[model samples]
Target: MSVQPQSFSSLEQNTESENHSSSSQSWTIEDSEQTYQIQGWGDPYFSINRAGHITVSPQGDRGTSLDLYELVTALRKRNIGLPILIRFPEILADRVERLYACFDRAISRYNYQGSYRGVFPIKCNQHRHLVESLVKCGTPHQLGLEVGSKPELMIALATLNPLQISEKEAQSSLLICNGYKDREYIETALLSRRLGYETILVVEQLEELELIQAISEELAIYPAIGIRAKLGTRGTGRWGSSTGDRAKFGLTIWQILQAVETLKSYNKLDCLQLLHFHIGSQVSSIRVIKEAIREAAQIYVELTNLGANLNYLDVGGGLAVDYDGSKTQKNNASKNYNMQNYANDIVAEVKEACDQAEIKVPTLISESGRAIASHQGVLIFDVLGSNEPPVTPPPVIEEEEHLIIRNLWETYALINEENYQEYYHDAIQFKQEAISLFNFSYLSLKERARAEQLYWACCAKVFEIIKHQETINEELQSIANILTSIYYINLSIFQSAPDHWAIDQLFPIMPIHRLNEPPSKRAILADLTCDSDGKISQFINPKGQKPKDFLELHPLDNNQPYYLGMFLVGAYQEIMGNLHNLFGDTNVVHIRTHGKGYKIEQLVRGDTITEVLAQTQYSSEELLENLRRHTEQALEKNLISLAESRRLLNNYQQGLANYTYLKANDQESCIP
Candidate 1:
């Protein structure tokens, strides 16, 4: 028998029915934010404003909200487009001030004698703008720079070289040199002291003592020295493996003793003043920190007993930021303690250890890079579009429909909690038989269509029942996630948020605008890269699955523009990003508030196709030559006339000069 076609009227009616059931109010904006744990994770720095937008509070106050819509409007005029990094220098300043205030509070509450000297690790974020803002804000409170590599040292040295430092200022505002060192690195550290900055060379191994002595003798300059102790107290969190005894860097306890003896032998033990120890980054436990501090503080006392004049206890950078907003240690990304409590725990532990050791309280140094810079950088990107699947009932049920289609439809109509399992099982079994029979041409196309529709309709009803349920079995959970929509985003995940792809790190992702409007779709983000792995499927949720697989995004307005902002991306995201698919960095705009509004202090253009090519040692001239050859072949084959080919080549080359990221081609923006 000939199969009848599904009518358009039936399809339209089914679609409308399906859509009405899953109405927009099914998932409101408030529900979306709550589901994503936005309020929990976005404390102090980010919150939803009355305008239904995520307003940046630069001063850390609830007042003076900077509307992102206005900022985007300003950016359009200035030619600084979206997919930009909106950096608040004032936010950096506030963070620095907050760090100091906490330390100051701890010092005062404990009546501790030593000062808190905070230093920012340059490796976390070495952007010129971030570093400069840090220096400008941190320099006043004697916040210093910690450099692990030669290049980082150079950046620190060059940035600070112009600042005229007096003897008092030099003592207070210090530069710390850490990591594995070569002869050249040691030489550079010693050379930096000539500029009158009290630069400390931290010895990570025992042999580094000889290098420091040799260099000091060669230049007739005595450089300040510190020791990084490999503490027995290891951290617990994402970067915990990088700490402990057998870690990549730091000196063993035996090595630390040997280095101290070597210093004594050279009569330069006073140079061994700063004692540094790092447990790891994003350490969640306060107890781990206290234990580590006790171990290092005792070592500090023992060094003083051995006639080494100890002055500073450098507790290396592990101050965790609340990434998940749970405000508790629910995951590696969430820290249980706040800034003030972190400071108090460290100070009290150190003071008690030193007080019991019968030693003077040494100055405390913390290289809190992540906590300092994480809130300062916000990455903004726009959604190009979305991927939605067909969700409708069958157009018609033919009188002679296949047995499986009739059975499935009957099961769908009979669905209820009491008989859901039975009905769902029957529909699944019948749908499988219908698919197999249709593949072999034993069933008509119209019957096959009806069977498929019947299956989905049953599945949709099952989902609705599952939603009201307090607990769902694993089978139903898989079905729920299977129905998730896909959002196609403009920026490359590798170039923008690498940790999300690499280690499954979840940064706060939400529309910078439209927090007031309810989102209608449960979705995952697909980046611009051809690689399937370049997508963000995991999202933060306190009550749901650990990084519950999908994000809830609003269905596109289709007429107006919309943008999403990724928060706390200041550290490591930019520098660690690879040149995957040759999609370069996004446009960056430094945001600073002026009056009630904001001003773009600087707009740094991202790399072009030609520039990104240069990064991989591919010359632009060579690219043009290859293009020329391809065009010449096309011309000879009569694929294009000489004039059209020339025009095409010129446009291609001009595109090579344009931004590697998406840009507006006309008055209305189109995906590039």
Candidate 2:
């Protein structure tokens, strides 16, 4: 039987019917939550309310939820520009409390005699406010700080300085110093110990131990020591290589024993108070964590038997945050275990190892910086515009049109359900032929434009047919790519989400409002940076499938603003982001949840044009002077009027002082 051909309009009508039928299902806030997978990664903290706005319950599910849309609206009233970062201090506090509480439960259940102590790794996020807030929140738990560099050590020492004021506070707080230490670094850490902070200088290499011994003797202060053992059990993730014998930091079995013997000879084996091992950050599997802990625990017990005074078992930060919410080991973006499961396993493994060896269960220390900080920060940006294939009826082809263009038009006109595959193939062939013909000067520019338009229209038609189907063949899937729009967002991937661009790290991104409505468009986000790589093509898949290339989004409303939030970026994103295209930072506001509302505690302004230029060695005053000189020359030559020169210079000066990001239109600031 011959398949009947359908007109282009008929194909569109069919697609509209299919879309209306599919989207006609009642979409609620719950449906929105599922579509965005907010519950998967954002459980207990974020949800969509009945009013169609994303709500953040900073204190978790039991606390009052604040509307993110409303919060942005309030900030807009004060004229905050696009691409602002919103931080919830309460979420950080809540994460800390939950982390300690889980370990407490595990310790109680296992009857482990050692107490649990958590230290925030300063390298994870070095924002002063974020570090200070974590310190304050953890003061109750006597939460400590971990530093891996000279700068991070400086911050840790100063941030924890308040603890040194009171002897009780000093004893309660623990400061772990990691990384290869220099003389000044060792002296500073040892001096802090002398001043009564429970500082442990974790020896990363055998050489570091010698420096520690010499520095301590000179400072006349006995330094508390920890050994970072190179574990035999390897990790499993992007950062997994940092573990095992080939690891960059940490000493091997031979080196570790040498350090012990050297410490014994120096009579400083009594200073060996902690054993540390890192199995890499963002651990993907619970089995890996268990294995690493068992190996490290064995080493801890053996060190104790070797007469090294070990009072602390430090599991350096490998705790993972489930950015994709898969909760499976299939990918590196997520973890296969929850925080409680991790705690239980650590406590069980360590206690079993210690009980077998008949040794004391030393204090359990975890540097869980990612889990504590990832969820607390959200980067929000506006959708400036979208670039999509023209849906307007293809321009009427004259009779004299080229044969290649004629073939494309016929394919677009006669595509039907039965022969769309054949027609799609024909269109591709015709488009390629037209491109070759145009390059050979066989086709006019107008003819080429027409051919390109008809090509996209054909793809659009093919996409409409298969979009609602349960499954499409691989060849047919390219139609969806052709139909997807490029949404230009007011965000720089380098300035806000460097990991995504650098390492293919995925963060949960979704519309902040309009949850009651089903999104009708699929788009790949394009950032404002000039670089072609500044775009987010991979998105989190709710079903835990491979990341989707396009994000589902609502049709842009010309009358209102549309915003998207990139969540789980509080860990390394802020500090790791670079000034690509000189985009600088975003306006940051620290929010504290109150009763059914939130208080904006602080607003750190984003970098101005002047500030960013200065970082690149461009003096703003010199820039202005040069521009003024050029403008005066132009006026003297009568190339421009005096009034225009003044106006140009004034605008230039104003632009230098303005925020680095694009300014929001007046229409975008209004609440619908």
Best by TM-score: 2
Q: In the order shown, what is each candidate's alpha-carbon RMSD?
A: 3.3, 3.1
The estimated TM-scores of all candidates read 0.92, 0.95
Off by over 4 Å in 1: 1-33, 161-172, 438-450, 543-545, 663-672
- Please give, for residues 1-672, the per-residue lDDT of candidate 2 as tens digits: 222234545666777878766774666778878778898999889988888899999999678789999888788887777688999999999999999989989999989898888999998899999998998888888888999988998898778753532323445468999988899989988888755688999998788888888878887898899999989999987888888778999999999999989998999898999999998899989999999999999999999999989999999888888888778778878888999999999999999999999988899999999999999999999998899867655656767777787778888887878899999999999988888989999988988888988888798877867887888998898888868889999999998999999999999999999888888789999999999999999999865578888998998987898999999999999999999999999889999977867788988888999999999999999999999999999998999999999999999998898888886565344221
Residue 56, model 2, lDDT: 90
Off by over 4 Å in 2: 1-7, 10-25, 161-170, 394-402, 667-672
- Model 1: how far residue 415 lies from native, Å: 2.0
Query: In candidate 2, what residue range of length 10 has the lowest lDDT sum?
Result: 161-170
Give the clashing pairs for model 1.
29-518, 40-325, 41-325
What tens digits encode model 1's per-residue C-alpha lDDT throughout 1-672? 423335543664687568756764364556656855677766676777666777678888744668776676567666665678888888899999999999999999999998888889999999998898888877668778999999999899877543434324645357989989999999988988888777899988788888889989999998799988888887887788656778878888888888877888999988887888899888887778878888887888888888888888999988888787877676877877889989998899889988888889988899999999888888887787787755675445565666777677667667888888778788889988998998999998977877887788788777767867888888778767767888888788998899888888878888877776666578889988999998888887774247777776777877777788889998899988888999987788888887777777877888788889999998888888898999899988999899998998898888787777765332133211
TM-score of 2: 0.95
> How much lDDT does candidate 2 score?
0.87
Q: Go through the candidates in order and give each one's C-alpha lDDT.
A: 0.81, 0.87
